[model samples]
Target chain A: MTRIYNFSAGPSMLPEAVLRRAGEDILDWGGSGMSVMEMSHRGKHFGAIAERAEADLRELLAIPPEYKVLFLQGGATAQFAMVPMNLLRDRTAACYVDTGIWSGKAMEEASRYCQVGVAATAKAGGFTTVPPRSEWRIDSEAAYLHYTSNETINGVEFQDVPDSAGLPLVCDMSSNILSRPVDVSRFGLIYAGAQKNMGPAGITVVIVREDLIGKTIPGTPTVFDYKKHADNGSMLNTPPTYIWYLLGLVLDWLKQQGGVAGIEAQNIRKAQKLYAAIDASAFYSNPIDPAFRSRMNVPFRLADAGLEKIFAAEAAGHGLVALEGHRSVGGLRASIYNAMPEAGVDALIAFMADFERRYG
Target chain B: MTRIYNFSAGPSMLPEAVLRRAGEDILDWGGSGMSVMEMSHRGKHFGAIAERAEADLRELLAIPPEYKVLFLQGGATAQFAMVPMNLLRDRTAACYVDTGIWSGKAMEEASRYCQVGVAATAKAGGFTTVPPRSEWRIDSEAAYLHYTSNETINGVEFQDVPDSAGLPLVCDMSSNILSRPVDVSRFGLIYAGAQKNMGPAGITVVIVREDLIGKTIPGTPTVFDYKKHADNGSMLNTPPTYIWYLLGLVLDWLKQQGGVAGIEAQNIRKAQKLYAAIDASAFYSNPIDPAFRSRMNVPFRLADAGLEKIFAAEAAGHGLVALEGHRSVGGLRASIYNAMPEAGVDALIAFMADFERRYG
Candidate 1:
């Protein structure tokens, strides 16, 4: 079987080992004689999977005991509204740093629950750069300041999460979560859609401070209500159990890759190699600001606009698939998520070089 | 392989054929050479799967072209909010029938958005019967009336969907969806969680009238916004691709089973045999009123509560799995969904009769 590197942003590539294990266990998970998909959420087997998944995630993230880890549905997009619904009490406005498509979306959703204040925006920079923290206009009385740690579409990433003074800070780390190390204590809430770096597209991981629980707006559905989910071990309703099981496998894979710090070293090298290849060729260019180019998603453009289709086709021939950029932003985006091997990056870089040789 | 007769309530038993097909396609779906779980939501493979799934579903349900089918996440619990958010415009109150746990939860969620008028409640009847429409007190000035077509937890199914007098009717068919034929035009919206009588747990199927497209309260997340999901063909976000694919297979399976009408006939026989066994036995009894007893879920109790554990254990040994009742109401619940064969039900009945003879 010819293995291809998938760079489709999300619902992207998963470790082949994990996939094999999942397929093996699809019909009989860990001697339970039942498929993980067929197991009851309340059953002893699934309950253990859920518990271990949480414990593994906490350990992987070096999460504080004061923070509750929630495995939720509806992805990070759900958390865009849930954050304010659960935290925007006693505050008139919530501040946001608009970096790219994700934070822009976060801003749009947050506006529904609170008076949203744009503390900073990278729009003027064509969403290619993260706004400097010193340039931010934060409201001291804001409930929480929200930002996307990495923008999947524009391939922009924050090198550092901002300090919100005494106020809580929230980050949508959907695209680059678990790709690197971070201090968990700096943020009051951290949410990541599982599709990109975690596992599949169904589960959303939320790490929230204990104090943020039970503050949901009255109109919040019990399912999306953070307190209700947190109170009931994220099983207040039927969770996406299969996806949760897959995530557990991914977490196990992460541990084998020498944890976050070890993965970060590899990620830094991979991103640098890909970026260097793009910068070296006049045929291809990544316009993102030098300081903020995402380590996960790398977006670039061919010098000739018409070659976009040709470039994608050629890449596919070489078994490097899903290299097309976001539709809104036309070009090429190679999403080298945590599951993406260094070999895949090398293959992509080699393809870029070959394409440049013919086109340049 | 000894196949277990799974009687789980919502995340219930899937068709054996569907499970086998799913297992066969676990790694390479439709020759795509990628696990359905690994496919990008926007890729041709998943897009085709999603489109065909919707098309097949539309054909199966005989859904009108004017209606939109949304493959949403978050299950029926999320729909409890999406329904009121989309349909409660210019209406201060909505009518709801309290049939059982699902309807009660829907009412609770709806109450947060609008004043919910109890049209009729079966709770007074110990949640064993569906109140007659003649006993309903629907408000003329109210928004759409809502009810659960079948209560999975209480083993109560509505024999008839009440006429809404030209008003829009919304039904939560979580337990009984695709179990029988129904006129689609009578209801403005129908939502079902895909675990029972459909496919898997991660996906929720929502069929909404096109006219009820965009009336979301400001606080509703764009992900849950009816217009947002509808306009994008349920692809506004990365959907639960694997679950959706599995649903399409299940839908195809239903069509092969001679559609909903044929399945309903089989379901009736299954429920009748189980109910007959319960009623004939002095040691076993089903509390649900006969008039409203569900064809899908049959909840029963032993005359001696002390024997409940023994019954469940012995049933498990006999391969009649997941008969333990919901935590709120402790007893046995055998959910014979569309995929549950009459033979499975017969086995369950036989087990019950033998257990009662030996233990009574």
Candidate 2:
């Protein structure tokens, strides 16, 4: 069977080893006589799976004792509202940095629950750069300061954690959580959709400092409350059991790859090679500032916009797929996440050089 | 390779055929180089899968043209809040029929948003039966009348839909949605988690009348609003792609098993035989009224309550697992969902008879 190099942003490619192990375990997990999908969330088999996933994640990220890790549903979009709902304890507003479409969506959703303040924005530069920390307006009265570490659509990323101006820092790390190591203590809360660097869709991972929970706004749904989920071990309801199991498999595979530090080194190498190829070519141009270009999603434009479709179509023919950019922005994007091998990037680079030779 | 019978209430057994197919497709789906989990929600491959899933489900249940089917994240627990958040448009109260724990939870959540009037309740009878329709006092002015079609924990189920008393009817069919045929036109909205009769644990299916959407409460998150999801075809954000594909597989398998009506016959025969066996034995008793006993979950008690634990342990040793009841209620429960074959049920009966001969 020929497997392709898939570059779809989220719900993207997973480690081949994880998929192989998952397929083998589909009918009977660890000889339990029941598929992971069939086991009850409360059952001992799944209980062990859940515990190991959390423990491995804690070790990988070095999460502290004061932090509670929650596996929730509704994706990061749900967190857009949940953040304001659970964190806006007696506060009138929250601060958000507008990096791209994702952060903008988060700001809009939070507006429904509380006053949303745009402390910093990259919109003036066409969402190609992050507004520097020095330019950010500090709103100390706001409940927390929020930012998207990586903008999957715009290909903009924060090089380092920005000071939250003394407000508790919250981050949307959906597209880049495990691609690199981070200081968890710098943020009050970090939320991510598991579809990217973790596993598949359906599960959202939330790591929050314990002190920030329990003060949900009056109208928050119990399921949306951090305290309820944390108190119940994310079993306030029957969680996505199979998805949780798959996440566990991915975590196990991540550990085999020498953990986050090991994967992060490879991630940097892959991004640099691809970016260097784009910079060397007159036929291709990436618009984002060199300093803020995302290592996860690299969006670029062909010198002739008409050739962008042909470039993507030909790439798929070579078993390199999903190279098209976001529909909102018509271009070509290659999202090289942790699961993307360096060989895939090298192949894409080789194909680009050949295409340039013919079209240039 | 010893595939045993699993009787989990939800996140229960899946059709072995479905599991086999899922296992095979985990690497490459439909000869595509990428697995379904790797496909973007917007891509043509997953687009076909998603459309066909909705179409097959529509045919299976004979859903009307006016009903919009949504595959969402968060289970029925999320629906408990979403039902009131979206349906309580400009209305200050809603009517709820409290039959068991699930219904009680739904009512408690709804009360957080609006006035919840208990139209009828089986609590007076220890939740052993459904309150007669004649006794229901559904408020005409309330936004909707809500009920639980089957309670997974308490093992109580309604044999037929009750009169809504001139209000839009909302039903949580989480545990027994596809086990039988039902007239969908009668309900304003019906929601079910996919773990029991459908597929796995991450996706929630919402079949809502077209007119019931587009009017959410003031602070409802965009993802929580049915209108937003329905508008985007449940792609308001990246959906649980792999889980949706698995649900599609379950729907396909259900069709092969002769759709809902065919399964309904099997469900009846299985439930009847099990109930008959329980009734014929003086040593075992099901506390739920026979008329309201669930076809999905059969909860029973031993004459010698001390033997309950021993009974469950022995049953597991005989290739029957998860026979222990919910922690909230202490006894034995066999959740024979649609996927639990008749052979499995027959085996269970034989085991029960043997156990009684030795212990009775």
Candidate 3:
């Protein structure tokens, strides 16, 4: 069976090993005589699976005891509202940095719950760069300072954590989480959809500092309340059991790849080579500022906009696919997350050189 | 591989055929060179998978044209809040029929959004029966009349839809949605978690009348708003793509089993035989009213209450597992959802007879 190099951002390609393990365990997981999908979330078999997944994630990120790791549903979009709902805690507003589409969406959702302040924005720079931390306006009265570490659509990323200026720091780390390690203690809450670096779609991972929970705004659904989920071990309701199992498999595979540090080295190499290839070609141009270019999603444009579709179509024919950029911005994008192998990038670079020779 | 009969209430047994198909497609789906998990929600490959799944479901239930089907996240627990958030509209109150645990939970959540009036309740009868329709006091001024079609934990199910007193009927069909056909046209909204009769855990299905959406409460998150999801075809954000595909597989398998009508016959036979066995035995008893007994979940008790644990353990030893009842009520339960084959039920009956011979 031929498995192509898939580049669709979020719900992107998983480690082949994880898929193989899942396929093997789909019918009967480890002699339990039940598929992971069929096992009760409260059953001992799944209980062990859930515990190990959380333990491995904690070890990989070095999460502190003061934080609670929750496997929730409704994705980061749910968390967009949940963050303000649970964190607002008698506060009137929260600060957000507008990096690109994702962060803008988060800001808009949060506005429904509380007054949202744009402390820093890259919109003036066409979303190609992150607004400098020095230029951010700190709002002391704000409940928390929020940002998207990487913008999947705009291909912009923060090189380092921005100072929250004493406010609790919250982050939407959907695309770049686990591609590298970060101090978990720095953030009050970090939420991500599992469709990206974690595993697949359906399950969302939320790591929140304990003190920030328990104060959901009135009328918040109990399921949307962090304290309820945290108190219940994220099983406040029957979690997406099979997806959680698959995410556990991905975590197991990640550990085999030398953990986050090991994957980070590969991720850096893959991004650097792909960026260099685009820089060397006159036919292709990436618009993001070099300092802020996302290592996860690399969006680029063909010199002739008309050929973008052809470039993507031909790339798919060569067993490479999902190279088209976000619909909002018409271009080509290659998302090289942790699961994307360096060989995939090398092959893409080679294909680009050949395409340039023919079309230049 | 010894495939045991798993009787989990939800996140319960899936059709073995569906599991086999999923295992086969886990690596490469339909020659797409990507696992269904890897396909972007917007990509054509998954777009087709999503559309066909919805079409098949629509066909199976014979859903009317005015209703929109949404595959959502966060299970029925999320729906408990979303139902009131979206359907309350400009009304300040809604009527709820409290049948059992699930219905009670739905009522508690709805109370957070609006004035919740109990139209009827089975609690007075120890939740062993559905309140007669003649006793129901559904308020004409209330926005809607909500009820649980079946209680997975309480093992209570309504034999027929109750009169909504002309109010829009809203039902939570989580545990028994596809076990039988229902007149979808009668409901303003019907929601179910995919774990039991549909497929697996992770995705929630909402079948809502078009007129019921687009009027969410002031602070409802966009993802929680049915209008936003229905507008985007449940692609408001990346859905649990792989789980959706698996649900499609279950729907495909259900069609092969003769759609809902065919399965309803099997479900009826299974429930009747099991209940008959319980009724004939002096050592076992099911407290739920005969008419209200759930076809999906059967909860029973041992004459010697202390033997309940021993009974469940022995059942597991005989290739039957998860026979223990909900922690709240504590006895024994066998959730024979649509996927639970007739042979499995026969085996369970034989095992029960043998156990009684040994211990009675």
Candidate 4:
């Protein structure tokens, strides 16, 4: 079977080696007489697997000793609730940056738990650019400052770490984690959903500083409390073992590919190649200001909006799939995550040029 | 590689056919040129897969139209928190039946959101048997009545549906959801973690009556609220796609096995054979009362306590694994979920008899 170049925004392409390795072990993992899916989490095998995954992730991210890496469930959206519940810490309101849909939604969930103060917003730029950090509104006594490091839907990324300045910085890094490196000690907490660059769609990775662990508001559910999860090593209840195992394989693959720096170089090349192709052609356009454009999810619009549907159809016909942009934006998107080989980007660029010539 | 009989409490064995099919498609699924793991949950391929899975499950359980099936995350323990968060409308207390560790934990989580009233307790009996229905203390003004159909850790199951009167009865069938037929109309909500008798360990299946969807406390997080999830079709934010797809395959396997009833017969036979072998041997004993012993999980002890470790090691040598009981309870436990073929049970019995002869 011919494998397609999948450009799905999340749940996008995975390393072919990872998939191949997983398939080989689906029946009997490591001669244990059972699939990884069938192993008990408390068993030594899965326990070791989970430990290796956590250790590998820490090595790749250079997470500080003061950080606790939690392999949590309920996705990053759940973190939107959990962050406020745990980090509000006796304060009534928190500062939020509204770069796009994800951060906006996080603010909405935070509103349910505590008062929300808008620190910055990119809505005036149609969410195609990040608001200038110098102009961000901040409250001196706010509980924490929250932002989205990368907005998957709008394809806008924080250009550099924002200066939270005396306040705890919390970020939702769902769309771009593992595609590049971040200084882990610079922030109080960082969270990412596993579908995009980490692994698959079941687990969420939360890296919280030890100081932020145990402070949930009164009446918070034990499952949502960061302290409880960190205390138990993310096995407060039975964890998503199969997904955790799969994530470990991906981390191992990443380490083989030379860790975060190695993959980041490839990601830069893929984004540059595809973005260069879009810029060279008069028929395709990217709306984000060049500096803030995301290297992971690149959303582009056709010169003729009427051709969007046909463009996606033709792309799929050529073994290219999931290039349709999110419904919120009525154009096309190519999410070139770390797993998307540079060759995949070349394929996408070639298809775009041919389509432009035919329909431009 | 040899496939052995696995008796893990959760994340237990799956059907060989199911595992084989999943392995084959781990690279490219159903000629779609994309692994199911890489597909967008909102895309056409995964949407069809999700639809077919829900339809097959509804057909298997005979769930009524008034109920909506939610494929969720955070496992069943999350549901323990979600149950009280969404169901306790105006009522400040809920009734709970405690049979084992799972039920006991559920009550603990529920107590954070509402006042918890213990209707019955099996702790007095060492959680070996279910408390009789006549002995339960019912609370007239409680929000709802909750019970675990099968306790995974304790190996206890409710023999018959307890009379809930006009109250909405919620059942945690995490360990034995599809192993046998049930009248869906009799309960307001039934939830199962998709590990034991369903699929993998990432997704949780929640079948809630339509009336229970919209109610939650005023401050409930959007992700934890059932109404928001139902409205978004469980794409509230990227449902665990790969686990959900794997579950779809298992649901299809169940259909081919003549749905639940056909598997129920096989389950009964496996339980009877394993139990009989233990009863006939003077060197082994099962503590649960006969009428309420779970067909899915059977825990037993060697008459000589000192031999337990050697027996487990010897059993593993003979291709029988994960027979160690939960740490809370000592001795041995064999979890023969639907995926374990009768041949596996026979192998386990044969292994046990050999161990008894050598070590008795």
C-alpha RMSD between model 4 and the true structure: 1.2
Highest lDDT: give the candidate number.
2
Candidate 2: regions farther than 4 A off:
none
Worst 10 residues of 3 chain A by lDDT: A130-139
Estimate, for each residue in A154-215, the C-alpha lDDT of model 4 and write its tens digit: 88987688999678999999988888888888899999999999888999999999997687
The candidate, 2 or 4, that scores higher on DockQ is 2
Best by DockQ: 3
TM-score of chain B of each: 0.97, 0.99, 0.99, 0.98
Cα lDDT tens digits for candidate 2, B106-166: 9999999999999998998889999889888878889999999999999999999888877
Q: Tell me the spans in candidate 3 whose CA falls farther than 4 Å from its real position.
A: none
Candidates 3 and 4 compared by DockQ, better number = 3
The local distance difference test score of each candidate is 0.87, 0.94, 0.93, 0.90
Q: Model 3: per-residue lDDT, tens digit, A1-360?
A: 899998889799999999999989889999999999998989899999999999999999999999999999989999999999999999999999999999999999999888999999889879999877889997999999999999999999888988899999999999999989899999999999998899999999999999989988988888999999999999999999999998999999999999999999999999999999999988999999999889999999989998899999999999999999999987999999989889899989999998888888
lDDT of 2 by residue, A94-142 (tens): 9999999999999999998889999998898899998878898978899
Per-residue alpha-carbon lDDT of candidate 1 for residues A270-317, written as tens digits (9 for 90 to 100): 999999999987888999999998999999998898998999999988
In the predicted model 1, the residue pairs found to clash are: none
* DockQ (model 3, Cα): 0.87
**What's candidate 4's DockQ score?**
0.85
User: Ten consecutive residues with minimal summed lDDT in candidate 2 chain B?
Assistant: B131-140
